[model samples]
Every structure is written in C-alpha cells, then in structure tokens.
Target chain A: MSCLETIQSYSLRSIGIGERLLPRSDFTLCEQVVLIGSGMIWNVYFGLMALTTGFFLATAIALGKGSANPWLRKPAEWFIFLFRGSPLFIQFFFAYFLFLNLKGAYPFFDPFTAAWLGALIVLFLNTGAYSAQIFYGALQSIPKGEVEAADAYGLSGWSRFRRIVWPTMLRLAWPAYTNEAIFLFHATTLVYFSGFPAWQQRGDALYYASYFADKTFNPFVPYPILAGYFILLTLVIIGLFGLVNRRLNRHLPANARSKMKLRLNLIR
Target chain B: MFSYCSDPDTLERLWWLSCYLTTGVHFSFYLSFLKVIGILAVTAPVALAFGFAGAMSARSQILPVSWLGKAYIAIVRGVPDIAFFLFFVIALDQGFEWLRHQALCPDWTDPIRQGNDFLVCPQAKLPLGTAPQAVHQAYAFALAVMTFALVFGAFVANVIFGAMRAVPKAQLETAEAYGMSPRQTFWRILVPQMWVYALPGLSNLWQVLIKATPLLFLLGIEDVVYWARELGGTKTARFTAYPHGDWRMWYFLALLVFYLFMTWGSEKVLSRIMARLTRGQATTGGEAQRKGAPA
Candidate 1:
C-alpha cells in the first residue's frame, strides 16, 4: 500500500476504527509508524485525562497535608505515603484485583475490569498521591516573605491565598510538577500490562507495539517508532510547561529567573 | 507440617490450612518472592555500574562520547520503561540469535525473515532446541535482568550525573591547587564527594528499582504476579488436593501488604543512612545534627 493508503487504514487502528485486522505479514516501515502513531492516541488520552483530573485532587490533598488540623493532615499524609511508596505496577495489580472483588460483590461494577474506567482510576489516584507530595513540598517551601507581604496588605482567607500564596505555591511547585507530569505519561504505559484487560483489542501504544512485535516477530521496527513518538511527545510537554514557567516567572528580573529544563534526575 | 494431621478427611480448618499453605504451589510462591529479591540484588549493582559508566561517559571531554551518554539517559526518560521492557526482551533475543545465525551458518541462506517466522540455523538457537527447560528459564531471566539494568541504569546515570555536577567545583579547584593531577582530582575530590549529594536521588532510584521488580512478570519471568495469578485462580476439587474459589483478591492483597512492608522498611533504613550521611556535612541536616548535640 502507498503511505497515504497505509495511513488511512491504520491511523485509527488502535481504537479499532480504520482496519479490521492489523498487518500480519510483510511488515513495512509505513505500517509500523502509522500503527504505532495510531496507538499513541490512547497514551495521550490516558495521560491527559488522568493529569487533568489528578491536578485538582492533588491540590486539595496538598492543602490537606499542609493543614494544621490532624484530621485532614494525617489521612492526606498516609494517602501520599501509600501511593508514593509503592510501585505503580503493584498499585495497578492491587487496584485491579480489589476492583475485581468489588465487581464480584456488585455486578454493576464490572466496568472496572477493563482499561477505560479501571486503569484510569488507578492512574488518577496514583498520580494524585505523587503530585500531592510534590505540591506539599512546594507549599512548605513557599517564601515566608511572600506570606508576610500578604499579611501586611491586610489580605486574609481566600483573598490572601489567591493574591499571594497560591501563585508562589504553583511557581515553586511548577518544576517538580513538570517532572510528575512526565513520569505520569511514562506510567500510563503500565495500565494495559496490569490486570486490566484491553477490551476489543483496544490497547495503548506499548500494547499495539507488542501486538505488532508478536505478530511479525520483529521488535526492532515498531519499538523504536514508539520511542521516537514518546520523545517528541515529551518535548512538546516540556515546551508547553516551559511557556507556563516563563509566564509564572515573568514579573521577576531576568537575572533572577531560572529556565525549566528536562532534568531526568527525578523519577516518580 | 504438623503431626496432628493424621486423617486427611477429618483434618478440619487449621490443619487443612497448614497443609494448604505448605503445598508445592505455596513453595513456588515463596520462591517467587526470592526471585523478586534475587532480581533486585543482581540488577542493582549491575545498573549502578552501567550508570557510573554512563555518567563518566557523559562527562567525557570528547563530544561524541558525551553525546552518546546523554542520548542514552534522555531516550529512556521520555518513553515508558514498560514499553522498553516489552520491546527489548524480544529484540535482544532475536538480535542474539541472528548474530549467532550469521556466525554459525554463513553459507546456509534461507532468509531469516520468512513471512513471520524468525528462522535461524538449529545451531544458532539460544540455549539450543534440545536444551533443558531450566536453561530457557534462565535465559529469559537473564534477558529480564539486562532489560531492567538498561532502562533503570539510564535513570541512575541521570541522577549520578546531576550529583556529580552538584559536587562543588571549588572542591576540584582546591584539589588542583594542592597539586593533584586531573585523574587524582576526579578520584579524590569529585567521586568521593558526589555520593553525599547523590544519596537522596540514588535512594529514590533504589526504591523505584525495588517497585519496578514486578515488571519481570511482564517480561515473562514467573515473578510474584505470575505466582499470584497461578495460585489464586479458581480450581475445581478434582483438579487439585485443595480446591478453592477465586482467591485472586486475597492473593493480591497479600502482595500489596508485602510491598508496603518492604517499602516502609526501606524508608526507615534509608532515613537512618541519610541521618548518618548528613552528620558533619554542610547541609541543613548536618547543621541540625550539629545543633542538636550537647555543646
């Protein structure tokens, strides 16, 4: 098939849209690129949806963790510790099995056995716990001077937080938050491999890559294609976050500002 | 295990439970835990070695060597490691066999890629077709270990590289002023001092590495997850000595608790080591320790 024809047939192959059957024999470069790129839709979906939802929940959890009230702080602390301490792999398994039992008890909950809801839930909670810890650390590290300035301006309650504390918290946390986001994207690949079944052969990038690899017995072509796509995706993320970081630091003098670069040192 | 387990049918709840726990499958389950530990023990040092080399190479004065190291670290960071694990195992296996094929059967040229089959000469089969089952298992395990090391080593290199950079440039300059050679400066001032800076990242990496051991199951090594699924699946009374309902939930719960305990214990030990390392250093923890001591 021509590259255009190949693209038309395999572009949405991951969600079972274009092609009924994956290319089985005579694997071509066009097929590898198109199919793997198609599978990336799920990766982007999982990462974006989970990150969007997890962001708000993480903020709340971070606030709770930093709260003076033990009722709030203790549970938040344990939640962060539990999720952050364990591997995402185990969390996926444990969540899957727990959901399995739950489904057995309540037949209505069987939807949790599949990737969409079940894996998303695990990714959501797991990323929330991780990001919450990052935000908590950022919240603590917010400059005393900033809060003091707010107090001097007669700011209190929500006004004080909105005008002063919140911005600084986000600014301080932005770098770490960026790291958390990258790691979450990487972690999304683990969803299918865990206990959650991929319904209708609908799987993510890695899933489809494995499928192609298994089918063709050629790992060299497909895996690197996925890797290249991920690198590009990661660069896009870095670029987007870099813009936000710049905006956050915009008011500061140029000499005082630090550029946000991809520091692979931090792993979730 | 118990002497009171005389009559099999009359053996009620406790005795039956004891026998069931001591069954061959349970032994395999326990051995799987050791496998997890064994992977960690083997992978940790090997990964560290790879990381050290990677870090050193990245810091190399030569542009190409540094670029190669930097690429290794960056490439793994973006992509999900599970993808690499899934991809590399088969790729490495094929790569090995293909190399063997080229070497052992140079003249015999039926295309290696015939339709979908990766056909190799009989002699080029890794472990050979006639090799024992244990050999195949060992080969798979070795592949899993190498994949783990390759992926995790990149992360470690990133950490170690940052830590190496974090070691104050002044320390190296001081060593230089004291008449130390370039190699001596690196050995005496840089490498030794970098660990203290590196410990936090390395400790975090260590925990991540521990958590990542379960991916061995995905790599087709029969680790704990495999055992859990195997032992926890539903079984009819006719199929086994001790038949049970689907108990995967309980099995996974056990795994969860085991992991939680392992991580909790490691955190405790790491904190103690952190405390020890922080003593007499220039950081906040060191300052705190110095202040807390009696004058």
Candidate 2:
C-alpha cells in the first residue's frame, strides 16, 4: 500500500476504528509509524483524564494527610503508603484480579474489566496517591508568614484556605507535580502491557510498537518511533506545566520566582 | 512436601494448602524473590560505576565526550523507561550476535535481515546453540542486568552530576589554594563531599529500582510476577495433584505485600543512613543534629 493508503487504513487503528486487522507481514515503515502514532491517542487520553480528575483527589488527600484528626489522617496516610509503597505493575495485576472477581459476583461491574475503564481507574488512583504526597509536602512547607498574614486580614476557615493556602501549596507543588504528570503519561504505556487486555488489539503506543517489533523481529525501528512520540509528549507536558508554573508564581517578583525544574527522570 | 501430600485429593483443607505452597513450582516461586534481590545487589554497583563514568564524562572539558555523556543522560529523560527496558533487551541481543557474525563468518554474504528473521550464523549465537539451558538462562540474566545498568546509569549520572555541582565552589577553591592538582581536587575534595548531596537521590533511585524489579517478567524471566501468574492460575484436577480455582488475586496480594515490606524496610534503613551522613555535614540536616545534640 502507498503511504497515504497505509495512513488511511491504520491511522485510527489504536481505538479499534479504521482497521480490524493489523498488518501481518512485510510491514512498511509508513505502516509502523502511522499505526504507532495512532496508538498515542490512548496514551494522551489516559494521561489527560487521570491528571485532571486526580487533581481533586490529590488535593483532598493532601489536606487529609495534613489534618490533625487521626480519623482523617490515618486513611490518607495509608492510602499514600499503600499505592506509593508498592510497584504500579503489581497494582495493575492485583486490581485486574479484583475487578474480575467483582465482575464475577456482580454483573454491573462488567465494564471494569476493559482497559479503558479498568486501567484508567488504577492510573487515576496511583497518580492521586503520588501527587497527594507531593501536595502534602507542599502544604507542610507553606510559609507560616502567609497564613498569619491572612489571619490578620480576617481571612478565616474556607475563605482563608481558598485565598491563601491552596495557591501557595500548588505553587510549591507544581514542579514536582510536573514530574509526576510526565511519569503518569509515561505510565499509560503500562496499561496494555499489564493484566488489562486490549480489546480487539486496540492498545497504547507501546503496545503497537511492541506489536511491530514482534512482527518485524526488529526492535530498532518501532521502539524508536515510540520513544520519539513519548519525547514529544514529554515536551508538551513540560511546556504546558511551565505555563502553569509561571501563573502560579505570577504574584511573586520575577527575580524571586522559582523556576520549574525537570529534576528527576525516574520518579515512580 | 509432606508424606501426606502424596494424595492431595484426600488431604484436608489446611494440609492441602500447605502442600500446595510447598510444591516444586512454589519452591521456584520462592527462589525468584532471591533473583529480584540478586538483580538489585548486582545492578546497584554496576549502575553506580556506569553513572560515575557518565557524570565524569559529562563534566569533562572535552567537547565530544561531554556531549556523549550529556546525550546518555538526556536519552532517558524524555521517554518512558519501560520502553528502554523493552528496546534494550532485543537490541542488545541482536547487536551482540551481529557483531559476532561479522567477526566469525567473514565469508557469509547473505543478508542477515531477510524479511522478519535476524539470521546470524550458529557460531555467532550467544552461549552457542549447543549450550545447556543453564548457560542460556545465565546469558539472558546477564543481558537483563546490562540493560538495567545502562538505563539506570543515566539517572544515576544525572544525580551524581548535580551532586558534583552542588559541592560548594569554596571547598574546591580551598583545595586549589592548598596546591592540590585539579584531579586531586576532584578525587579528594569533590568526590568525598558529593555523597551527602547525592544520598537522597540515590535512595529515591533505590526505591524506584525496587519497584522496577517486577518488570523482570516482561524480559521473559521467571521472576515473581511470572511465577505468581503461573502458579495462581486455575489448576485442573486432571493435570495436577492439587487443583484449585483462580487464586491469582491471592498470589498478587502476596507479591504486593512483599514489595511493600521491601520498600518500607528500605525507607527505614535509608533514613538511618541519611542521619549518619548528615551528622557532621553543613546542610540543614546537620545543623538540626548539631542543635539537638547535648552541648
């Protein structure tokens, strides 16, 4: 097939759209590139969904962890420890098994077995737990002066937190949170590779890359293409988070503003 | 196994479980936990060596060598590390075979890349085609170790490079004032001090390394995850002495607990080490120690 024909056939293949069958043999370079790039839709989808939704849970968790009451604190602490302490790969296996058992008991949970819903839940919780830890640290490190100053202005309770505490915690947490975001996106690659089966061969970028690698018996081509897509995604995340970092630190003078640094590569 | 395990069907509930847990496959499952530890024990130092070299080269005055080191560090930055794990295993295996093929079979003119097959001559095969299964396993294990070292070395290099830069410039200047050579300043003054700053990152990397051990299954190794799945799946009465329904959930739960224990233990030990390292240093940790001490 010509490159256009190949793109037309396999462009949306990752979501089980255009193509029902993946290329079997004599796979062309165009086919590999298009199919792998097509698979990135799932990666982007998982990352964005988990991140946006997980943000609220993370905030609540951070607050709970910082709470003085044992009732609030213990569960939050254990939640963080439970998810953060174990490997995510194992979490995926254990979760899939749990969901499968749940489905067995109640047919209502049938949708939980699919990668789109099931794997997404795991990613959501995992990121929530990790980002909670980051945010909890940020909450602790929020300068005492900021809170005392807010108190002097009669800003109290929810209003005080809304105006003063939350922004500072976010500002302090943004850099590490950026690293977490990138890691989350990278982790979307694990969904298919784990216990969650891709329905009808609809998997993520790594899934397609490995597929091509298996077919061609050539690792050099497809994996690099996967890596390239991921690099681009990483850059996009950094750029987007940089914008937020700037906004979060906008109130501070430029000279005193803390810049976001992509300090660690393998955080998770 | 027990004397009564010979007739699993007649065994009582607890006894059946005990026998099931002590079966030969379960023994191998137990052994795979050691394999994870073995990988960590070996990979840690090897990766440190690789990272030290990478950091030194990046910090090198020479342009090309510095770029090479920078590239090595940068390569792992943007991509998911699992990609590297998946890529490196096959890539390294083929690379070795291709090099050996060129060296060992000079007269062979047929293209190695014939459609989907990587057809290296038999002489080029790692551990040789005639080698025992044990040799092949060893070779695969070695490749896994190398792959882990290469990817993790880059992360370690980034840590060490930052730690090296973090060493206060005044200390190096004092070393120069003492008539120490540049090499002496690096070895005697810089390397010694870099560890305190590097410790936190290294400890974090250690946790990451621990979590990453489960990926061994992806490398086709019979690690804990592999055995957990194999042994946990439904075992039919016709096929085996002890048959059970799908018990994968329990197996994975056990694996999860093992990892949690491993990470929790590491955290405790790492904090102790961090405290010891910080006791005499000028960092905040040291200052706290100093103030808290009996004066």
Candidate 3:
C-alpha cells in the first residue's frame, strides 16, 4: 500500500480511530512513524496535564512543607516522602490495584481502571511530590533579604507572598523545575507498562513502538524511531523551558543568571 | 501456621487472620523484596564500572573516543530512560542472536529480515529453543541487568565527569611538577580526591537505583512487582489451598512499606559513609568535623 494510505489508516490507531486492526504485515516506515506519533499524543497529554496541575499543587505542598504549623508540615513531609521515596513504577501498580479494589467496593468509580483517570492520577500525585520537594528546597533557599524587603515596604500576609516570596521561589526553582518537567514527560511512557491495561491498544509511544517490535520482531527499527521522536520532544521541552528560564531571570545580570543546563542526575 | 490452620473455615478471630497472612503467596511476596535488592547489588557495581569507562572515554584526548562517550551519555539523557529500557533489551538480544546466526550458520542465508519475522538458525537461538526454563529466566534477567546498567551508566558518567573536574587542578599540577606522569597523577591525586566530590552524587544515584528496581517487572523479569500482582490478584478457592479475594491493595501496601524501610535504611548508611569519607578533606564537612572535635 502507498504511504498516504498507510498514514490514513493508522493515524489514529492508538485512540482506536481510522483502522481497527494494526498493520499486521508489510509495516512501512510511514505506518510506524504515524502510529507512534499518534500515540505520542497521549504522552503529551499526560505530561502536560500532570505538569500543569502538579505545578500548582506542588506550590501549595512547598508552602505547606515550609510552614511552621505542624498540621501542614507533617502531612506535607509524609506526602513527599511517600511518593518520592518509592518508584513511580510501584506507585502506578499500587495506585492501580488500590483503585481496582476501590472500584470493586464502589462501582461508580470505574474510570480509575482506565489510563486516562488511573495513570493520570498517579502521575499527578507523583510529580506533585517530586516538584514539591524541589519547590520546598527552593522556597527554603529564597533569600531572607527578599522577605525583609517586602516587610519593610509595608507588605504583609498575601501581598508579601505575592510580590516577593513567590517570585523568588519560582526563580530559584526554575532550573530544577525544568528537569522535573522533562522527567515527567519521560515517566508518561511508564503508564501503559504498569498494571493499567491499554484498552483497545490505545497506548503511548513506547506501547506502539513495542507493538511494532512484537509484530516485526525488529527492535532495531521501531525503537530508534521512537527514541528519535522522544529526543526531538525533549529538545522542544528544553527550548520552551529555556525561554521561561530566561524570563524568570530577565532582571539579573548576565553573570548572575543561572544557566538552565539539562541535569540528568535527578531520577523520577 | 497453627495446627488449626488446616481448617481455616472453622477458625475464627485473630488465629484465622494470622494463618492467612502467612500463606504461600505471602512468602513469595516477601522473597520479591529480596529480588529488588538483588537487582541493586548487581546493577550498581556494573553501572559504576560502565560509568567509569564512559567518563574516562569522554575525557580521552582522542576526538572520536571522547565523542562516542559524550554521545552515549547525551542520548540516554535526552530520551526518556523507559524508552531506552524498552528498546535496548530486545535490540541487544537480537544483536547477540544475529551475531550468533552469522557465526553458527555460514552456509544458510535467506535474509534475516524477510517480511515480519526474524528467523534465525536453530543453532543460533539464544538459550536455545530446548534449553531449560531456568536458562531462559537467567537470560532474561541478564538482559534486564544490562538494560539498567546501560541507562544508569550514562547518569553515573555525568556525575563522575563532574567530580573529576571538581578535583583541584593545582593538585594535578603539583604532581606533574614532581616529574609524575599524567597517568600516575590521575591515579594518585585525581582519582583519590574525586571521591570526596563524587560521594554526594553517588549517594543520590544509589537511592535512585534502589527506587528504579521495580522497573524490572516491566522488562519481563519475575521481580517483586510481578510476584505481588500474581499473588495478590483475585484467587478462587479452586486454584489453591489458600485463596483470597482481591487483596492487591494490601500486597502493594506491603511493597510501599518495604521500599520506605529500604530507602530510610539506605539514607542512614549513606550519611554515615559520607561522614566517614569527608574526614580530613579540605571541604566544609571536614572543617565542621575538625571544629567539633575536642580542643
């Protein structure tokens, strides 16, 4: 079949659109790229949604962790420790199985069985904990002078936080936050691999790549293609985050500005 | 395992609960925890060796050797590591088999990649088609270890590379001034001093490597996660002597507690090591320790 036909047929193969059965034979590069790219939609969706929501939740967690109140600090510390201490792989399994038992008890919560709800929830909480730790570290590192400056200007309570502390915390945390975002994108690939089943073969990039590998018995082709796509995606993420890092540090002198190099040392 | 455990249906109260908790599946659940540790014990040293080679290569004066090392570290870092894990196992297995195919069967050649199947001579089959099941499991475990090492090696190399750079240049210069060769200085001064700087990153890497052990399940290894799922899923009474309802939550909770304990224990050990390693060094930790000593 022609490349156009292959694209038309397998474009939405991941979400169960266009073609019912995946290309069983004569798998073309066009089919592999299109199907994998289509699958990447889910990766992007999971990463974007989780990172965006996790960002706000992480800020609250950071604040809670740094708060003097034991009620806030203790729970926040436990939450961070619980999620950060374990593997995301285990977290996915634990969450899925826990959700499964919950669904058994209450039939109304069936959505947790699917990746959309189940994996997303796990990713959200996991990233929240990780980013919270980063944010907490950053919040602690926020210069005392900034807060004192706010206080001297008659800024107190909400205004002081809004004007001084929050910005400084973000500026301090931006580099680490970028690393978290990159890993969150990578962690999305683990969703389908976990206990959560990919309904109708609607899965992520690695899932589709694995499908192709299983079919063709040729790991050389599909995996590199997937890797290439991910590398490109990562570059795009780095670029976007670099832009934001620049804005966050726009006021600083060039020598004082923190360079946002990709540090692969941190694990999710 | 009480004597009354033979008739679980008749038993009541805590006695029945106690027996149920110590079932055969629970034993497997407990064993799985050891498997996680086993992966760490094997993977850490291998990955460290690989990282050492990678760092040395990256620092090589030869352009291509350095470039190759840089590329290895960069590619792994750029992509999602899970992607590499999913890819490398199959790719490495196939590469091995393909080499074997060429070596074992010289006369027979009908295109290895014919259509969708990857057919090879029976003589070249990894673990052989008729090998014992244990051999197959061992082969799979080996691949999983390699995958973990290859992926984490890149990160470790990054850490080691930075640590090597962090070693003061003046120390190396002084060694060179004493007529010591570059290699001698690297071993005597650079390598020794680099550890103090590398300890922090290595400790963090150790924690990550510990946490990443669960990914073994995804690689098709019968690790802890696999056993937990297998043993904890809804089991009918017909299947075995001790059957229970869906108890995966409890199984996973056990896993969580196991991991928490492992991490906490690791932190304690790592801190002690760090303290020991920092002694007498020209670093902050060393200075603090010296000051705190009796005057």
- Please write out the lDDT profile of model 2 over residues A233-263, one tens digit for every residue: 9889999999999999988999988788887
Overall lDDT per candidate, in order of appearance? 0.86, 0.93, 0.88
Please compute DockQ, using alpha carbons, for every candidate against the native two-chain complex: 0.60, 0.78, 0.71
DockQ-based CAPRI category assigned to the predicted complex of candidate 2: medium
What is the TM-score of each candidate's chain B when compared with the real chain B?
0.96, 0.98, 0.96
TM-score of model number 1: 0.94
B31-74 in candidate 1: lDDT tens per residue?
Answer: 99999999999999999999999999999999999999999998
Number of the top-ranking candidate, with DockQ as the measure: 2
lDDT of 3 by residue, A190-253 (tens): 9998888999888899999999898888888888888888888888999999999899899999
CAPRI quality of model 1: medium
Determine the iRMS, in angstroms, of model 2: 1.2
Worst-scoring 10-residue span by lDDT in model 3 chain B: B24-33
What shift in Å separates residue B235 of candidate 1 from its native position after superposition? 1.4
Pitting candidate 1 against candidate 3, the one with the higher TM-score is 3
Q: Which ten residues in a row have the lowest lDDT in candidate 2 chain B?
A: B1-10
Model 2, stretches more than 4 Å misplaced? none
Quote the positional error of residue B290 for candidate 2 in Å. Answer: 2.0
Candidate 3 residues lying further than 4 Å off, grouped into runs, are A265-267, B1-3
Which of candidates 1 and 2 is the stronger one according to lDDT? 2
